[model samples]
Target: MSAVRRLAGFICLLALLAGAVLWITRESARPRESYQEIGLRWLRDEYRLDDATFEKVAALHHAYFATCSQMCRQIKEATRPLLMQTRRQPLSTSTKAGLRQQEQKLCDDCELAAKKHLLQVADLMPEEQRQRFLDDMLSTLETQRLQHDLDMSAHTRR
Candidate 1:
């Protein structure tokens, strides 16, 4: 009877341990892909993105998306006057001054955000990796620029 009780207690302890492990494992959550992922998907679908290019594209996009989000917020704040005054053909001088101030604030915010993000990225990445990342980004930009020029040339020829 004593042996049976000990076996039952051990089995119960094992069951509890197994349950705890399963619970912890099940609790692991998937991180949602950032807005960068959406932008990258759009690029991939619209353009021909190779594997090597896609990796860099995604990383560059992550940085750009972060910057763009900050810029968009600033832009919306800056352009609030144009959005708000739909009824008026011309805004008053005071209103124009307010708009100018908002635009200046937006530009300042964008500059600050870019500075802060670049500093953070440099801190996080190794020197070589950061250089490589920068090169990759510049290459992507160059490719896009070339494509745009070609597109314009084609349109002009037509």
Candidate 2:
């Protein structure tokens, strides 16, 4: 009877250990968000959006990124020739001026695209939230643009 009792106790301990291992594996397997995803998560949580609204907003967000990415590629392509020239010789004054103007126009176009997307998102927001959201987002966008300009100018001076 004592041996039987000992055998049952050992079996119970094994069962508990197996359960613990399974629990740890499941917990550790939970997926983590990448840095980029955290911004989207913040937008959802900060705006207190419902699932349906969030879905629409996320769709718009992704579309804007796609447009913005193309603008970035255009800027890169526009500069490629100048980059190649700079590697071999200094750029002519007119060439530098033309490239700078082209870059500015691309940046302006990208900004306009961003603003239009922001307005669309604001339109979908609740009436009470719409103005506030626009105000916050536009202000944030302007802040980022200003910082980017500052950084670029500083780099140029260097």
Candidate 3:
């Protein structure tokens, strides 16, 4: 009887642990638009943007991000078959070359989208406000990059 109870308890504990892990994984994998939204909020607050201007900027930013995401997904889908096939087998020279080409193309596509978005944003803003917005974006990007590097280093140490 005691052995039976111990076995049941162990199973229950395992289930609880699995549930906790799934919850954490789902949360982490969640599509977080908070980074972009918060950036817009900061721009409004720090730059004292009026509500109408803020709304227009936010709309434009959101549209650009949406379009960028769609473009990225399409590119990924296009290369995914070859990429997955290469992953399944040992990499040949040809496979490596194809993969490198795909990777470079992906980078170029994303860069193009980013440049287009920046140009659109610049066109939308006045000269002074545009400079401030650019400055804020630069600082935000630098801070994020530094944080990412720190996180990677910490994980490597661990």
Listed in order, each prediction's TM-score against the native is 0.39, 0.68, 0.53
Q: What Cα-based lDDT does every candidate model obtain? A: 0.62, 0.79, 0.70
All predictions: root-mean-square deviation over Cα? 13.3, 5.9, 10.5
Off by over 4 Å in 3: 1-33, 74-89, 135-158
Give the Å error, residue 90, model 1: 0.8
Query: Comparing candidate 1 with candidate 2, which one achieves the higher TM-score?
Result: 2
Tens digits of per-residue lDDT, candidate 1, 32-149, equal 6666677667655544555765666567657777777878777777666544554445667687667767765775566556555544444444454666545654566557546644
**Tens digits of lDDT, candidate 3, 20-110:** 9999999999987677898888867776677887788899899987887887686667455444553346556676567657655775676
RMSD of 2: 5.9
Model 2 score (lDDT): 0.79
lDDT of 2 by residue, 20-131 (tens): 9999999999998865468678877877777988888889988877787899899778655555564347677788678868877887888899899999988777787788
Q: What is the lDDT of residue 67 in candidate 3?
A: 83
Give the clash count for each candidate. 0, 0, 0
Which segments of candidate 1 are over 4 A away from where they belong? 1-34, 38-71, 83-88, 132-158
